[model samples]
Target: MKRFCKVRWIALLLLIVAGTAFLSFKNSDNRSFQLAKNIDIFSSIVKELDLLYVDTIDANKTIREGIDAMLYSLDPYTAYYPEDDQSELEQMLKNTYGGIGSIITWNTKLKRSMIGEPYEGMPAAKAGLKAGDILMAIDGQDLEGKNNQEISEMLRGQAGTSFKLTVQRPGVEKPLEFELVRRAIELPIIPYYTKLENNVGYINLSTFSGKPAREFKQAFLDLKKQGITSLVIDLRNNGGGLLDEAVDIANYFLPRGKTLVTTRGKIEQINMSYKTLREPIDLDIPLAVLVNSSTASASEILAGSLQDLDRAVIVGTRTYGKGLVQTTRSLPYGGQMKITTSKYYIPSGRCVQAIDYKHRNADGSVGRIPDSLTTVFHTAAGREVRDGGGVTPDIQVEQEKLPNILFYLVNDNLIFDYATQYCLKHETIADAQHFELTDADYADFKEMVRKADFKYDQQTEKILKSLKEMAEFEGYLKDASGEFEALEKKLQHNLDHDLDYFAKDIRNMISIEILKRYYYQKGSIIQQLKDDPDLKEALKVLGDTEKYHSLLSPKATADPAVAEK
Candidate 1:
């Protein structure tokens, strides 16, 4: 009877396995059929449109648009690059391009393409191009009516190629001509690294692209040489790049053969476990990683893995959770498709993907996973963490919201324009770290605004207008007429008063812009550090050894009362 029972179990197992295999085969066949059917339908529609459309349809554009729409439904990162757009893909991955190394913007008001910012030490800046210089022609080809992208394409070429550029300066009467040479402009991975007060080293990692690990290691070593006792890796605004680079970076602080992240997907063969392959440079160093909402992907991986391993104190706000991993597949005819292949789980076995793109809302919108729904995980030290959101900072420092007046000034390009004019008048200024816009300079900026006839809508005024409209519709306007009139008078936006009220903030913005004109990106960072709230908090945490160590302790995070304190 026992033998019969064992035989029966084996038979049932075999039957179940056969049934599953059959179902899988059927599903695969069905998917193939559906795919073929859709392709046929798409081809037929395109053929019909080509044959019967009233206007001449751009087949390539239409097809590309269709491809884009399909990919858009999946996720933002999953993208298709046509043959012509391969340069853009390369720039994104490699972060290197053969160009004059300047940012251009289409000045709608001026109806010209303006040099927004010329990178320092690049061909454009070396050739005396300044911010607000209007591009009239490139290589003698008229840039009139050309958009920023078109102008950019014209600027970019093979390294060592020469081009003649003509630009109208803001102060100059004649159009200045310059013969410029395009060079391989590689954006800085670690833009700035320095030893701060109390032997705390700061490394501002702008991106993870193109040998960031190697560059970051060098920066760290240099900081060590400068006698840095602790390190702060600023991953703020770093949207992330190569996965391997993130792994390599994490390896610098983790032991060999320790898992950093694991990617799981439908294709089991491609699922991977990324580990620290090298011996750590400093495993015992007090590390603080600065992250904000803009910090994502590989940035999250570095931050999350560090947090999970209890290796570093993650400061600032929550990270921009993007746990999805993308892999590029070569397409037919010199094209490429970057497809979202897998979701990655950090060391704590938590996928920090905040949005559920698969289960989108009825309105075709995606929402972040709420705090209530996030599942509790724990760090290596048994500190309670959570998944389905972002890497919550060990010490949360909320970013200060800029005043509305400042926003309007920036949006209207008033600050930028003032800085451009200031640059024209002044040949030199104090270094980025010490530069300040004087009270007299502020007065000049205000005068410029007045002369420009700047106007901006106040949110309060818009809300009041809406309230008045609602009151009228509800038959309450007659009763509240006096109150409405009073509100209107009280809420009236006074430009001069607003300007003075937000002068400090405005001056700071202006000073930073002016500094950029003189010192470039690194200078801007140096200036920003002088007044950075996050950096201040990070310094505080690093300065206090007891607090830093305690924050990483399991008991501190596990106990709610202690955590709150």
Candidate 2:
């Protein structure tokens, strides 16, 4: 009787397993059928619209729009690229292109494209093109009424191809022309690295594209040769690129076989861990990483992994949380689709994807996961960290908001125009580090602002006006009329007073813009560093050995009192 019972139990278990498998197979088949039915319906709808619409339909554009809407409903990262847009994808991945190598901006007032800034050593700069030069024609083709994208396409072509470009200079009466050859322009991943005071080194990494690990290794070695004892890797405003490149960079500081990141998806095939494969270059060097809201994707991977391992002191504001991984699949007709395949977790086993794209609101809007909803995760040293948001800095430095006048100056292109005019008048100026706007320059700028009739809205005044309207609607305006009028008078915008009150900020903007025209991007960075609050805070943290070590320790992170101190 006992033997019979055992046999019966085994048979029942086998039957249950088979039943589960059958159910799984049936569900999979049902999903396939649903997908097929929806696709057929879509096709029929498109066919009917093409045949029955009153006006002739642009089938290609309409279908592409539909595809875009479908994809956008899923996530912002997933996108469709036709053959013509493949170059843009390639550029995003490789950061290289064959073109004249200059940023062109559309002048709304003039309704023409103009050279914004030319890369220092690229073809446009080499050919002596200046910023603010209005593009007139390209290869003998008139560019009048052509948008920036249309003109840009005309400027880019095969390497070694030559083309004629004509531009009208701001000060010059005649149109200038140049014959330029297109070359492969690869933007540098590590733009600038230098040894700082007290044996500290700084390396500014702009992107993770095109062998960033290799370039970064070389930069570190060079800095070591300069006898640096500490290092700062600035990832500020780096949107990130290839994931493997970020992994390789992490390997430079981590030990082999250490898990850097893990990706999980619907399919088991894509779920895997990325470990450090090579021996580290430096394990004991004091490291500080600078980050901001613009630091995202692979940038967050590098920063998050380091913070998780207690390998670096992250400074500045929180990072841009983007823990999603994407893979491109080739589609028909030379098109491609970049799809989000997986969500990644760092060494601490936390996903820092701020927004929950899966559960969108009724109006098709997405919101970030609130702090209260974030799950707490512990770092390697037992330090508490949280997920569902970007990586918070070990030492949070709040950025100061710029004044409204500065915003107006930038929006009106007054600062840019002033820089252009300044460049024309003064053929040479002080170097980037020492450049400063003189009192006479500020006076001239003020006069120009008055002459141009530059107008800007004061936010306070606008808010007061809104309050008045609301009060009138709610039948409270009469009672508060005197108060509103007094507030308006107090908040009235005085351009001359503002120019003098915010002179320092205006001068800084003018100086930086002018420096870029002379020294390009590197110079601007150097100049900005002279007064950077973040760098100052970083330097202070690095300078104090005990404080730096304590911030990364479990005791400091766990104990509220210690952390506050």
Candidate 3:
């Protein structure tokens, strides 16, 4: 029995030695061998410490943290998500979860989580949550110092559960609380759609969801029934969703059997082409696609496919360049890892991937794609198109930045607070499209601002005081220190004068907020459309059939400089 026990121990030792040898051999290969070697050594050390240490240690936690840190070294996207992170991952990919459906951003000036936007028909919107209302706490927990994700997680739960929100508006000294019920927040794929004119239809597709393709088909058919001959598909800040959905959407506009996109990868099966399978809903309809820098992945696929077929004229900014395809691998403990499995190529035979992370400069910056690396491709009308960074627009539209005064007004919650107070005082307002802040209402708002203490960060006052002290000590401003103090006081008085300069911008913001209170998301969008240059451009493109065709046709030889040269 003693001999058998000794032999068993020897066998176990031999197995351990063999395993270590095999791992070491594997680590001594490839460019990332050093990284693997460090991980191996760290693992070995951790095992040894856990087994032989005088105190107990959490092996799983240590390993998880180490893995997280290691992945963080690669890039922001490359992450280690454990079993606990699976739900969050699902929320991002599928874009559905139980929560109070509203988008919130931290107002740095106000130091509160202000509602930036709300999805139409969402629980938050339905519960009377408007943009700019500060979320002080959730279910009695103060949400200060939490990130967007953290706040989202806290707000989300099993459907039908209730959560209370403590909110503080601008003028309100006391915090108001509301009991909100958590529900399955499945944000719709198509938020709003309408006929732009007699023969033109516009559909705002927010995501490529499970039913987006079907929804789009119905929308197109409905428009066709309503005498639609042209369409504008807005894909700004869409951020993309499912690949199959994109293909389905592409098939709705392109001819049957036309190749939409293809994927190439190390894996043989992933290297397959995606073609339109069904008859097109509208092959002859004049389609205009609106894309911006935030439009990515599946959105790019739809736009690129349409561009390749000369089916649509893409307008607005260059698209967000993301050509890599990710596939989720189910791991142990219900966790999944979404690994980059393949590179997606659009119909023009070009990859719209922006970054070449493999090639980096000495300073760790990504090097530009050289001219030699660039290649040419053609669209259906023989239009030359190059790919690498992103899809360039047929016509570029420059974005306008908000003025500083307007920025402060929104950022500081002055407008938000005024809106809340106005909502409380007034029972109703004019329709979203017709609503305008009257002169009397503006006067009342200004008066309220005068009574309220809106403290902006006073860097100028601090600097001026410091400079005055320095000047007095240096004997240069011993005489003029008084003058500097007087000047500072005069500037303080003049600070109110800038209000007139910022009034129009401030009023616009106020108008948007107030409109949202009355008309909801659709109303705000309608109001913004009055000033939206992109919509106007899209309308013009759709209105002129000849000009639209010209824009879609081959203008010049593809510029290599734009792609890689």
Q: For model 2, how does the per-residue alpha-carbon lDDT over 48-111 read when each residue is reduced to its tens digit?
A: 9999999989999999999999999999889999987777778777888889889998776688
Mark the 10 consecutive residues where model 1 has the least summed lDDT: 554-563
lDDT of 1 by residue, 51-91 (tens): 99999899999999999999999999999998777777788
Put down candidate 3 lDDT per residue, 1-565, tens digits, no spaces: 9999999999999999999998887766653877788879997999898999899889888778878876655544565568776666777676678888888777766566777677777778787777667888987888888877677778888889998898876556888787888877777777668887657898888887556888998887888789877898989888888888999988888889988889999979889898889997778888889999999989999988888888888888889888878777787887777777788998889998877766667887775465457677888888887778678778778877666556656766678778877887777988876788887888887777777655454556677878888987888896786688688877573436656666776777788887777666677677766677777888888888789988887776687888795
- Screening candidate 2 with a backbone cut-off below 3 angstroms (N, C-alpha, C), the clashing residue pairs are none
How much lDDT does candidate 1 score?
A: 0.91
Once fitted onto the true fold, the runs of candidate 3 whose alpha carbons sit more than 4 angstroms away are: 1-36, 45-66, 72-75, 104-119, 125-151, 163-180, 367-374, 440-499, 502-504, 556-565
Report the error of model 2 at residue 314, Å: 0.2
TM-score for model 2? 0.96
**Which parts of model 2 are misplaced by more than 4 Å?**
1-4, 556-565
